[model samples]
Target: MADGLLVFDGYCGFCTRSVGWARALDRRGRVEMRPYQEPGVPESIGTDAATCADAVQFRGPDGVRHGGAAAVNALLDTVTGTRVPTTVYRATAGLQERVYRWVADHRGRFPGMTPYCESHPSECAAST
Candidate 1:
């Protein structure tokens, strides 16, 4: 089963919204949602709490882990109303990490963001 593992912050309202968005747009049923805050979640990705803390993570069909902007870019490939940006995103990979970092650092300015960012960020910074 080639699943798209979507790692998110269980406590964040914005992160929850992103999960819902993924479910709504993921008609292919390829994405799996997991909250990094859970006890066994990080182990699933072979990562530690500190490393996984600030970003959303994705494990693709190959079992390769992708975090930060790349993970978000990968998610966009399968989600709706996200294809266009995905293309643009591909062209701007050089800047994606920086962008994600900025958002992660200051996400509180945006409402519904606390769930994912009392300290860090990753809300579909990946895709659709």
Candidate 2:
């Protein structure tokens, strides 16, 4: 059985690229990924498009869902055998949100499929 699911935007070049990188680095094989837009997802997990519309989402050890940079940090900890120091991770949390927004805002320049849950698939699909 998989340890937990990382629900990600499969269509995003950045998300796919990052997952690939993490998979390579994850010697423990503790994490697995599912595209958030996939039909297999439980509505209880994402709820609505906007709530899980970020660059990344992860269901953690306790099965609680997490998103954005927190998900990324949790992945790092799961792979590295130690938690990322909270002081360092939280210190930049605010800035991380801004950066994530920027990436979400300009996802078109990304070189792969549209983000999995593009609010404007018409606009986003045109780019793909």
Candidate 3:
């Protein structure tokens, strides 16, 4: 878990479950998972809550930080050379940002997930 820190939305059902799934498959335990809401969580990884709320954040042991799909690539690229995320990161020459935005915008649509706004109306209003 020293290799990387992955910060995700703890309150989000989908995001929480996704992290659980990742933990199950993380053979080497290289990625440490933390929820953005936990006290002193993101700060430990050198990221702020706002940044983590907007996109998944990955902070490598080398101190490099990457967000969204790029964050995923930071974790999966070397271990799984041709994984779907890395492939998307490579294939989308110019639209990767849009993809991340879309995913965040529609995150509530994922199974078991409620829109951030609907679930935490006050928090979502502040974030947006």
Highest lDDT model number? 3
| Per-residue lDDT of candidate 2, residues 66-87 (tens digit) | 7777777776776666776334
Question: Each model's TM-score, in the order given?
Answer: 0.74, 0.73, 0.74
Report the CA-based lDDT of candidate 2 relative to the real structure: 0.65
lDDT of 3 by residue, 1-128 (tens): 45778888876777866776777766777778777776687788787888888999988766888888788777675334335766778788358778778877887777755433345554432332
Worst 10 residues of 3 by lDDT: 119-128
> So what's the TM-score on candidate 1?
0.74
Candidate 2: segments with Cα more than 4 A from true spot: 42-46, 85-87, 111-128
Give per-residue CA lDDT, model 1, range 58-102, as digits (tens): 886668788888888777664543467568777898899899878
Runs with alpha carbons beyond 4 Å of true place in candidate 1: 78-88, 113-128
Clashes of 3: 0
Q: Which residue pairs of candidate 3 clash?
A: none
**Model 2 reaches what TM-score against the true structure?**
0.73
Ranking by TM-score: 1, 3, 2
**Residue 124 displacement (Å), model 3:** 17
